[model samples]
Structures are given as structure tokens and as C-alpha cells.
Target: MASSSTLSRRSLLKVGGGLGLLAAASQITPAWATGKGTKVSVNSPEQLLSLSAVDLSQAIRGGSVSCSEVMTAYLDQIETYNPTYNAIVSLRDREQLMDEASRADTELQRGQYRGWMHGFPHAVKDLAATKGLKTSLGSPILKDWVPGHDAIFVERLREAGAIIIGKTNTPEFGLGSQTYNSVFGVTRNAYNPDLCAGGSSGGAAVAIATGMVPVADGSDMMGSLRNPAAYNNIIGFRPSQGLVPFGPTKEVFYQQLGYEGPMGRTVQDTAMLLSTMAGYDSRVPLSQKSNPTSFAGNLDTNTQGLKVAWLGDFNGYLATEPGVLDVCEQALKHFNTIGGTVEAVDMKYPMEEVWQTWLTLRHFLIAGIASGLYSKESNRALMKPEAIWEIEGGLELSAMDVYKASKARTSWYHALDKLFDTYDVVALPSAQLFPFSADTHWPKEINGRTMDTYHRWMEVVTPGTLSGCPVANVPAGFDSQGRPMGIQLIGRNKEDLKVLKIAHAYEQAAKLTQTNPTLVKS
Candidate 1:
């Protein structure tokens, strides 16, 4: 499917510009606004929640269920469960969504159906600007700030006939994977509330996990997408950097690392979302031209003779919790059973250098985007300590440091290039640590080793983040305590379809996506 012509930054400003900001306060409030939905209740659309996006889309197209019915079901689910998980924040009035869905239903009745997302309820990452809705990006400084335009990807979703609902929580400015910010308190895991959901896509992941929302948009730089999917037992795909362009950014052509993509309960759903969120725009210089029609259309089920390598722990370079690797290793065995050869391969790259390069470049970008906040003590104080540290760390770095990091990044990609020549896909733990206490800021240490900072425990996702490769998270099952684990499926550069093909193969082989999280009865 071609991306909507409305996905340019110019289009964004025309719809909703991001300008309004609240006065500064050191003690910033979380952005989890509790807005009530329209009291219009329909018969339970609950069963529809069990269906995949592909099925739901077809059902809506075929008139098995009206768009209004599908949306009402999800709205009811959100109202009932959101208070429990705090995954959805800055929620829009349900009346607005119902109206949109009703219109969509009317359009379908008139044979004016849109695309796959014609009537689906979707929310982009809170970090993304939503035209009429408040987008705080989990930072209290931007609380009450409503954008006049939609982020490009968001507009793309809207044009596809998605009923834009609300925004999901994220770390302040999407800086961390933990998913907490001054604007939004911690988002809890679907399986266990005490544990973190994983972030900056944490809320999106949790929304999918808790049946709050079927599909959500997320950006992954340092595992923002994959880590949360692993923690919530869902699917998160980081498209090859330029395939799903940053849509809005200062430097588009050579962004060191970062991607905006889709996350959902199933890979097919993810592929469907990706098809809409992707396309080339000359406005985004780095955006690559490609027709994503085949992403969802050609989901090959055969993994016979695919070369899969499970690189557990980057040959012990990344600090990992004991059971995480075991979960991934077991996942590879499924590949082997499906006629795919899975083997453990030792990477011949300097792991420390890669980590350092990611940190240097990441903090550098964070520092620039957040520099305005640093100018004001109250705004800076509103940010988490790690965020301030990251800004300051970036400020302290010399051009030489960035150059060296870039050099390290080159070597790292080169090493992976060689590895990919031999392996079609590489599997690893999406995050080094399993879901941890939601109340806790970050894991201070893992496996008896001290983490350098709040997001240090998430280094396991760095490889894919830095490589600009297409990475998809597939459910690998749960741990001893029932916390979910996901294996990271890394395909060669821009091999987006190949990666999804194998992921679909694995999911079908194990029949894992059918499993759903059952919230504990209080």
C-alpha cells in the first residue's frame, strides 16, 4: 500500500502544529489524563478483540460487524482496563472516536471503504504529535501542549481510516526504554503490574497486551519497540532505518540510529500496519522508495532450510539475566525443529565499542533535542536524572568522540555484514533483563553487575538498533515466573520481508501468538 500524501511535515503543520507549552514546574505531573468516553454503549465487541487486524479488517469490509461496533468494543475495554495498567494516557473523549467510527461505518455502507485500518482504533507513541490531542511525550513540560498537526505517520494512519483514539506513554522525549516520564508515571507490564512494561514504547506495548488497543505506533532507537514487545508478549518491528522514515527530524539522511514502525499482537497485524506507515517522501531525504504491498500480502509460511543463528549474549558481551538466554535458546530449537538450521555463532566485533558508539551518538541526539529544556532549571529539573546526565554527557563530548563512535559503528556494521553473509537471521534476547518492578526507576544491577545508568540493562537491543536492520520481536514464551520473553529476529539490511517471513514461520510453527494474557482477578 502507498503511504498517504499527507505524511509530510508540511502536512503535519497544516493539521496540528506543536507549539503550545505549559509553564515550567519542577514537579511535573504525569500525562495520564483520565478523560471519560461517550457513554454510548454497544453490545460487547469483546470477542472481536480476540481477532487479528487482518481478520477484523476483512470483517469490517464484509459487514460482519460495523466499524462502530468494533470501536465500541475497544473503547469499553480501554475504560475497563486502562485504570489498572495506566498504559494509555492523554486519552481523547470516546464520543469523538465513536463519531469517527460511525462515519467510517456509513462510508463502508456506501461502498466508500478506506484501507485495512478503515475503522480500527489506534494511538501513536505519546512522543508523537497528535493534531488535536495533548502530546506531552511523557515530559510534564509539554503537558497540556496540543499539537495543531499530526505526526506524519499518525496522519498516514488517519488517512487509512483509523479512528485516532489517544496517545501512549513514553519516557521523557523517548530517551529511555523504561517508559516513565514526568508527564506519565510508570506503565506496568500486562503479565505483572509490579514489573515494568518496557519503554519508550512501553505504553503502546502494554495497550496491546492488556487489550486496551489492538495496534500502536512506536519508535525504536535503543529497543524502545522490541524490548516492550518482549516484556508484554507481543510483536514489535524496527524497520530498516529509512524504510519507515523518521517523518519529522532535523537530520533525515544520516540519522545514526532510530526508526518509527508498528507494534501489534501478531506479526500479520504488524505487517498490515507497516504497509500503511511506510513509503518514500523526497521531503525526508533518507526515505527509501519501495512498495510495501507485499509485506502483508506475501507472508511466506515456509522456513524450511532458512539459515538461523542464535547469538545469545553477543558471545557473553552483553550482561544478561540467567534465564533470558535460556528462553531465546529454546526459541531457536523451534526453528531447528521446523527444518531451519539454528546454531550458536560467536561475533568477532568489539562489543564494548559498539555499546560506546551507541551511547555517544544516542546521547548526542538526545542532548540536541532536549537542549531547550536544559536552558530552564525548572524544565531541566522536571526531567529524570538520567536524562539530565545524558544531556550533559553529550555536551561534554568532542567532535572527535562522535567521529570515533561513528568509526566504531562502521566496524560494527561491517562485522555484522560478514555475519549476515553466512546467516539469514540472528536471534537474541530483546532485553538483557526480564520485566522488573514497575515502581523501581531502573535495575541498578543485573546478574550481580552494576548497570551504568537507568537504561543500561537494555543493551541487548543495541546491535539491531545500530545496524539499521529490520528487527522483529517474536514471542519466545515465558520465564520461570511467567514473565514473557521474546527472541529478536534480525534479518539482513532492508530485508524486511525476509525477517517477517521467518517470524511468521516461527509463530505458526509454535502456535504461540494464540496465547493471550489473562489479568489476575483482584
Candidate 2:
């Protein structure tokens, strides 16, 4: 005779079909997650929610805390704060989640241990499929669509013992950095409810910032992860291209512009999540075959006499709002205190050429994926103007145009590669301006400069994105209006760990994550 908990566990296994299969196939056995490391006991939900993800993991694994209690604290936090931020959508039922948590505890008691994320509550970005959960991508056309399968990263997260709570908000088809759409409305900045949360990872960053989730997975095509992290004052890491297996999608090679990464309140948490999300999958031929566990190891590294190239406004080629550069410069000073020299380096590469290359490639890739939606008049009517513009721009491009863009992109890469010969990491502002009003669509101009395109204001992020290198957005502190900003620490290609090391050291020196968001505090 089977016990009720045993029956419930079996039912969960059936419900998580592919997830359960993946979990069994790749049982994550990291020493950091399962060790009887820290006996972290918490008396109240506040204390439990306050502990870092790493600490919480150890506490749950060591039996100092139960998964039900952790789930309860997170659920309470979400119930209280989610309404205001709109960071999480398609939220799961509380009773069902509690039952899952109870089953997780039962498994622990029976000595059937899972991985690091064992019993952790997690939410996938709206752009990624969440099996049973609706992945609206912030579009009303697909608002009711439920994915039957999870994205590769989501599958890995499930395999690592994460309970899928729901989906985070993103822009329509993740076309913009602002996280508002016809489906979920706007995802407010974690620091200020009235301001826009940068997207398409806006909801993911906000969820982490507000303690709604310990960590989150996000994709960055054009500063999606970095910009939102900057807005919310959290760590958003864009790993080296191909470092993380993204999809088993139809178009694999052409979709090189975007890559999924992790966001967290701290660098270690970001690194830990990255470790789980990375590694090769035969389905995704471009995925790296490196050991993912390497990222989960010690991040503390000596930064004595390290050379950092500060690409401020690309020598005034970029139009930045007032104080954006000053804040980033001040944040770079932390590297100096840590024995790393931050030198302002003028990029000799043609700035306009790089922007043109980005526009061409972005338009081509977006159009390739979205042409189906654009073909339908009813769907086109429901789509955002930015989506339509990208499709149309791509439709207008010739083979020669794409070839020229690719050539220019290669040239820009070589230029950045040349700088890497002298500098260990290249630094730039993660965004052009601080968080703007959630009511506004996109910035029309910056400092009296006319923006030609909807995403022109975000041109500052193109250099890092185009380099195909590892980039981490570290908090650059707040402006006069208390709006947050961040600076991008871009490292040489295939040096994801190096970037994380520098970010961790700078984080220790700056100690910006010590400040919680106003929403969370209240």
C-alpha cells in the first residue's frame, strides 16, 4: 500500500513529464547544494526570505528548514508585492504549490535528495516556454497559449529541482527593452513603481530584486538582461555566446544575437544559476561542451594591477542622458580600490558602422522568426509597432545588405579583440539613461538628440552584445532622482568566469547589493 505522499509524488512525476525524465537523466549532484554545509535556522519568514539563495539551499538540504516553509515565505512575498510590480504573471495556484512543497519535504525525509535547486520556487521569463504555464511573451495573441514543452534552460532548471511557480513578464515577442505589452501591461521598476522596468528580462530582474525569487533566468539579445538589472540594481550576466544551450528551436544558427543568462541579487547566486543553465546539448549543436560546474566554484580572485578599458559614451558618439556617464564613472572607481586601473579608452572603431551592423542583423533575425505572425493581418493588428518595424526592415534587406552588415560586425569584433590584447575587461554603461516612466513607450530623444529608431537610445549596449563576449551589469548606484543605473563589465570571448570573478570583487568593494529596493523594504 502506497502512502498519500508517495502517491502525490508519483502524480507530480507524471505532471512534470519531460522535467522528471530530465531530472532523472541528469541528477545534479553539486557538493555546494547537497552538503550538510550550513545549519541556517530562521525563526520567521522575513529571516528565511532574507537569506541568500546559497544559504537557503544549504539550509533546505541540511534539514534546518523545510521546503514548505520556504515556499510559504516566497508565496507570501509574491502575494504581497506582485500586484504592484506586475513582475510575475500566470501565477500558479497556492494550494497546488504548497502540495508540491510538501511532497519535496517528504522526499527529503525519505532521503531521496534532488539538486541545488531542490524545493526552490522559480519562475521562467515569459519568452521561454514553461510547459503547463502560459508564455504570453506579453502578447495577447498568444496569451492563452500553453507550451507543451519547456525550453532547454527551463528543462535544466526543472532537472535541478526547481518548482516552476509561473512565468515572468516580457515585451511582445521580447522585441524591446521595456517590459510592457498588450497582455501583462507594464512591469514596474523594483526601485520605483512609477518607472519602467527594463526588458525583455524586466520581470525577471524585478522578481529577484523584490525577493519574489532567489534568482531567475533571462535572455539578452539587446541589453534585455543588462538593462533591467541596471534599472532594478541587481546583477545581470550575459554569458559568452554558446556557453548556455538555449533551444531546440527550428532556427539555431541564425539566432546568435540573443543568449539566455542568469540574474540575481548577488554575483555568486548569478554564477550558481549560470552553472545549472550552461553546458552542451546535442540538440543545440552550437552549445559549449565545457564543464558547467566550473562556474559554481570559488569566484574570489585577486584583481591586483588588472587593466580595465572604460569605453565611456564611445568618445561622445553616444547620446546619453545627464548623470548617466558620471554615475558609471564613479562606479568604475571601485576597481581602482581593488588594485585594478580603469583607464578611459577611446574606441577607434567606426561607431556608426557598428550601429548599422547591429540594426541589420537584429532586423534580419527578428524578421526571420516573426514573419509568420506578420503575414496574418489579425496577428499584425495585435503586435507592437516595434515588432512590425523589425519585420518590415528585415523584409526590405537584400542579400548584399546582410553580407555588408556581417562584414562590418566582423570588423567591429576585431576592433574589440584588439583592445582585449591590452585590457582584461572592457567597461561601458549598461544603459543610456536611468529608468523612465512606465507610462511611456520608449525614449524619443536623449539630451536633445533625436532618436531615429525605437531602440536607438539603447545603442550603448550594442558594443558589448556585438562582441560575443561575457558581460556583467554591476550596480552603478543611484542618481539625484534615486533612479538606479549600472555599468557593463565586458570581458574577452570565452572568459565568462573571468568576468564573474571581476564582478564579484567589484561587488565586494562597492557593496551596492546591501541596499534593498524601496518596494521590498516597504
Best by TM-score: 2
Worst 10 residues of 2 by lDDT: 13-22
Candidate 2 per-residue lDDT over residues 1-522, each given as its tens digit? 101111221121111111110011123445554456757788889998888888889889988889999999999999999989999999999999999999999999999877889999999999998788888878888999998999999999988889999989999999888999888788999989999999889999999999999899999999998999999999999999899977878887768889899999999899999999999999888888888887777777767767787777876899999899888877876776777766667666779989999999999998898899789999999988889999999999999999999889888888888888887888889999889999989999999999999999999889888888999999999998999999899999999988898898889889999889767433
For model 1, where is the 10-residue window of minimal lDDT?
Answer: 29-38
- Per-residue CA lDDT of model 1 for 1-522, tens digit only, reads 111122121121112222212122223211111111122322347768877777677667766778888888888888888877888897788888889889998898788866778898887788887898898978788898998887778878888888888889888888777877766687888989888888889999999988877788999989988999999989999998788867566666556587789998888789888988898877687787987665756465545566666667765677888898777766666665556666666665678888888889988887877877888988887777888888999899898988888888877777777767777887788889888888777888889999987777888888888888899999888888999889899988888987887787777777777778887433
Q: What TM-score against the true fold does each predicted structure earn? A: 0.90, 0.93
On lDDT, the candidate that comes out on top is 2
Off by more than 4 A, model 2: 1-34, 520-522
